[model samples]
Target: MWGDRGRGGYVVHPYRGYGSRREAFLMGRVFRQTALSDRIPRYGVLRDLADVLRRIIRWGLPEVSVEVSLGENVTTVTTDHDGYFDVHLLLEHPLPDDTSWHHAELHVVMPQAEPVHSFAEIYIPPPSADLLVISDIDDTVMYTGVANKLRMLHRLFVKQAHQRMAFPGVAALYQALHAGPSGNAKRPILYVSRGPWSIYEMLEEFFQLNRIPVGPILFLREWGISWRKPWPRRAEDHKYDVILHMLSMRDDLPCVLIGDSGQHDPEVYARIVHEFPERVRAVYIRRIERKPDRERAIDRLRDEIRHTGCDLMLAEDSLAMAEHAFEQRLISERGLEKVRRESSR
Candidate 1:
């Protein structure tokens, strides 16, 4: 879900979902927004600040009814006190055997009011896919100093999507990974981020602006200060939980995990490798700092996962990663050449 709108005295916020052939899940929020909040622009520092403030002061519609349908399967659910609603539906039959995304519709079925309609998509990986690519967003794809709160906030509020700079060669590398060894296979790419759900639209715009392969964005919970709660809440084991969920959902597909050394990626990924050794093919961590301690720590993680036969590469640039991918037969020579050509620019 990218944006929210008010209709028939209700505010509806839709969120994206990912699934396989036989099952799918849909999520969204129902709330009421203030007039001032509704006026906030979609870009600029002022707009960013306003978004944070609005999320804190927003009014949630508790016990609201929601209807979700994909083909003949339909389900009704109620929003919690926080205005969050999640509906898991079992499809009557499998989705079509195609690489394209499937569509699902959601309705805010409130009593004595016109239904508010929103749409979301479900991505089904093709059978020809040999590997899945799961990546981190903040420091790995875009330049967000997640280790430094002040710089991160500055980058977030001051830069528009077009103004945000992606790391060199990262887009080409991801595109190659998306098109696997055959250069035509539509390998599924999933992005996991520590960012809140409020920035979903901004992130989507950033991906498009930078030519990154779009995928299901799994974001952590929203955190904001409210009258009832004066402080923001922190998520515990969020990355681990989300990654585990994704791995469990697509157990048959081997995955290549991509992240950076900025935060707890090494630890989380190391644990995943230990637990599901056979499911992981390789782990790529973009080097962010030149600190000896960080490198030593990542090396230790590497040693820990070495027994799983999943190679751990701490690369300084996307070109290095692309070369390694080609060597591992994950991407073709043409894809590697494309990545090299794009990175040289």
Candidate 2:
């Protein structure tokens, strides 16, 4: 029988005799648990590896899902294992006909978990015809737990949790970059991040919160136990591979490179400049530390960069870097103006 409980709570005890109260209670508990599992944390571990494996093979592992709805039509795509997804939106009525402001939504769903929807506004404008910005995200956009030596060692060796900090003004800068002129929209922004591959959600959340431009993403895979090799080129090689691939994808337009001085950005960017000196218009290196050794290294890198023939801007902040990018003609003048205004506010 249905029963009333205190404080507006209701208890269901159906009079049907197909099942005993104990069985009903057990079933209720199971149902509640299933619902609860959806709210699990991003870092939450599953109890059954078999279930996770099955879900991955069947429904496909949930990476990031971006859905764009324009009136009757909708487009949806989930990122791959590398946390990169490609979406090609086809319109029955091309741009002008379907010119109503479109709504873009992104949701990242973990297996048996609640979908984390973007907290920020997602807007999709007509394709291209605007300045393009390709940025690196790890230490460039978000703090990848690398600044702290102890934490870095722990994440790299012991328990891996690379999704720790958020870089200041990263989201603001991206929002500005994504924005276009009063009538036109910004070209697609490509995000390339390094390693671990597990922080896809964290990175996505940062983007959503900041309302960063969403387009193609490239993530390098973790080397696992093989990270101990003395070769510093291991990580840089993956990024270089990405750079080369991107160069091939785009015909001749120069890209804006945003990276940090923490790792091998100087080395990699220097190499890119040497190979395609004209294709890489400007490099923005985030200067986090100012130790004497780092200063010397930066000086050495500056000398090396001078040889490559690409302009370099070493800024302690993303806004500064964005400004430098705009001033150097790496991005549109409006892009830099918008970022500066937002950062000042």
Candidate 3:
């Protein structure tokens, strides 16, 4: 989010959250914005670069008191050194099951400034959910060349949401997975990325522009930008942690993991399957890096994981992944047709 600017010169940023019937979570950063630069000017490449710089130029309001309320329950929490506030609330009553999303309000309490109020959207997956879909963003869904750091950084900062490209059939495939076999299953899709939290709004807009189903939670990394890691973050460990937390929270739900072989996705996913063999049904790794050795390694890893009761597919396109998902009963025939149509275009 660009954040809601208050007269007190402080901004309240509320992120999308997810929870179960027992507990709910919401996290955001409280920061100071000098001027009202919320809306980016639509121009050429230079204008998009300015927008990217604006997000990076942030001053966090540290140790600020933030109040979070879920239904009738309310709690107060303080921001961390980085101005990031993570609030966890225990619910006495279960949220409504008919709907997948619940609303929470966050109010910034400060003596020096006017009270700032922001709202966060929290999602509680229905008990009838068929599966959980977790996917990576970098090269799996978007066309960010992870191997080419210079080009990746250029596209990341110099391009706007409409200018960026989503992989062919990715939007259709993800929508089908979200709808599930009955077409209303509302399976929760959690996105994990190696990018920083600053780029959240851009990514959200990208999904909207591309018509991809937006998930409730997007797990982003905190690693600073560098040549080795452009939209840098901790290594594969960040993704592993996010996936582990999701699977642990939903013991009854089986998940399908999607990533690309451009980096260490195959290795991290293999490790997850070993740990939560029963909770993960399928792992789909896209062929981003077209090297004989890497492809062979993924193939070997796939064969090794077969006995763990989870199937790993190394596919070249989203359609191939959908076909395998259809065969596994993870997606419907109609969904496969949609993907087929999307891929052909």
Candidate 4:
């Protein structure tokens, strides 16, 4: 689920199910775009009620649906009786970076006299020679969930401020990537996420508080329960219009896709490789949870990697990937060495 906060809506975090599946829950925040009513509430103070409503629209709650994409295929799931739903993304052919983007749309239906409907798109741009690592802040690179399953579900919907912790070494790794000399280049290290748009200030505060590096942050504005949020505007109708739009802007650099194994990265990257065989250099997947038989799964995906000729890795830390990138001369020695030092510490 990926989204933002506004008067009328919010986007949810973009989710990916285990392997080739869409995440179980579609996350979004709902808010009234209209100004607060001047009338006082029957019980609570008018101002207090208005404030609460603002938070709800900004970061509290929103409704949505699940949409998953693998290669050219797409699957959609709706909320159940409990207003929850789950769908898996099937990866028959892993996409490569050159493939440009893997486009998927999720439909959200708000229960109303005239239902509100919305759509979401997952766009993965081709890698830049300088490399761009677009990632989600939640499960992809964090271990805030105490008991894994229980906490993960809670954080998935609630946006618990305290539970928002970074994965081991991720901060240091990102810092090294951005702080080192090579990182000062003109190309951008974009952070496009599905987290609340209103929370942008909060996220900036968190990044500074946590000493995380700065980058371009793009957030989706959450539409109503039924209203669909379309992908970034593009003139072309190529399924991967958004990503292509982003990639097309930068013609000089190849790209490297980084994400977790939880959701659409595998499928998205697979299609990217297929679409733009020349633009992507590698795909680095953080080995998060919800996986089945880790050893067997890695072995199988490894074979698939051999077939695709893409550098696929399951790393415990971004530093490990940085090390590989350094070895391949993808990153400058100073940057690689900095990551190594930070990771080792």
How many clashes show up per model?
A: 3, 1, 0, 60
Cα lDDT of model 4 by residue, 18-88, tens digit: 11122211232222243455464534455444544454443332244545555566666655432334454
lDDT score, candidate 3, position 34: 56
lDDT of 3 at 325: 91
Error of 2 at 67 (Å): 20
Q: Rate the local accuracy (lDDT) of all candidates.
A: 0.80, 0.51, 0.84, 0.50
Whose TM-score is greatest here? 3
> Which candidate comes out best when scored by lDDT?
3
Please give the lDDT score at residue 284 for candidate 2.
76
Position 115, candidate 1: lDDT: 75
**Candidate 1 ranges with C-alpha deviation above 4 Å:** 4-9, 35-57, 227-231
Q: Is candidate 3 or candidate 4 better by TM-score?
A: 3
User: 1 or 4: which has the higher TM-score?
Assistant: 1
For 1-345, candidate 3 gives per-residue lDDT tens digits of 443322226788877999887888888889876553446455655556665666776777888999988888889999887788888899886677778889998898787678888898999888889799999999999989979988987776667788889999999999999999899889999998877788888888898898888887788855555456554544758988888888888888889999999898999999998888788889999898689999898999888889988989899899999999999998899999999999999
Off by over 4 Å in 2: 1-132, 153-165, 179-185, 222-234, 307-309, 331-334
Ranking by TM-score: 3, 1, 2, 4
lDDT of 3 at 211: 86
Global Cα lDDT for candidate 4: 0.50
List model 1 lDDT by residue over 256-331, tens digit each: 9999998988888999999998999889999998889999999999998998899999998899999999999998
lDDT of 2 by residue, 204-303 (tens): 5456556665543434344332236532334657778867765664544556677888887877877888788767767778887777887677667667
Give Cα distance to truth, residue 341, candidate 3, Å: 0.4
